[model samples]
Target: MSKYIQAIGIWFLIIPLAIINGGLRENILIKLGDIALLLSGIILSICIFVVAYLLIPKIKNCKQTDYFIFGIIWFILTNLFDLFMYISEGGGIKDLLGSYNFLTGNLWILVVITTFISPIVVSKIKKRKGEIKNV
Candidate 1:
């Protein structure tokens, strides 16, 4: 539907910003090491989820389902972008896939989980607040 399309559009806008943030984090990580990288990634994931939560409500006719769809689209597109960048930079498919190794390179998984759950969490928070206000 149109709402889903709009969600995709919004995601397109978000993707570039995320890539820039990721690049900056990667640079910082090289200097500060894994702990700093992991901590920064966790913090960034929280911030991204919060932003998505706040923005989702503003889309006209958006429902919980739409947010899920948006998350899915965003995730797929980001992975594709990563894949493209890897290949373009002369990296192999194995390396591209290995980047997902949870034991080593799992920070992205946090982002994935946050993206999927953010809408639901935001909806619940809003509902709880509404209930509290009414009572």
Candidate 2:
């Protein structure tokens, strides 16, 4: 698929996640207390999405395995960065990490899946188009 289509897919994943998370934040966390982290979470999630999506695809042969490995690496890397931030800043926004859901964390994982699937799907389309052109 084209980048436009990929972006649409990303938006599809982001929107529902935004709704669910917004609800959870208002109903559970905000009602309880600790909304100081709200702005940071929004910023972080978007930043992570933008940075990872741009950075990951450019790397050569970034397969499903590559995406998965990169995801795990980024997960660890974020935690490590958080560790440093926590140490330096007397606990920054990253310290409140568990406040969000992970099962479908803003559909970031979906990007990883797309990384795996997009090449296969796009390549097949390309091949079919080439055949049609030849015929």
Which has the greatest TM-score?
1
Model 2 alpha-carbon drift over 4 Å, by segment:
1-34, 89-135
Candidate 2 structure quality by residue, lDDT tens digits, 39-85? 43554466446544443343443344444444444444445544665
Q: Pick the candidate with the highest lDDT.
A: 1
Candidate 2 positional error at 101, Å: 9.9
What is the lDDT, from 0 to 100, of the residue 127 in candidate 1? 56
The lowest-lDDT stretch of 10 consecutive residues in candidate 2 is 126-135
Q: Please state every model's RMSD to the true fold in angstroms.
A: 3.9, 10.4
As a TM-score, model 2 comes out at 0.42
| Residue-level lDDT for 33 in candidate 1 | 70
For each candidate, what TM-score against the reference? 0.75, 0.42
Stretches > 4 Å off in candidate 1: 131-135
Across 29-135, the per-residue lDDT of candidate 1 in tens digits comes to 55777665576557657776767666655566545565667777767766776688888989866776776676784576777667666755665576567521111
What lDDT does each candidate get? Answer: 0.66, 0.45
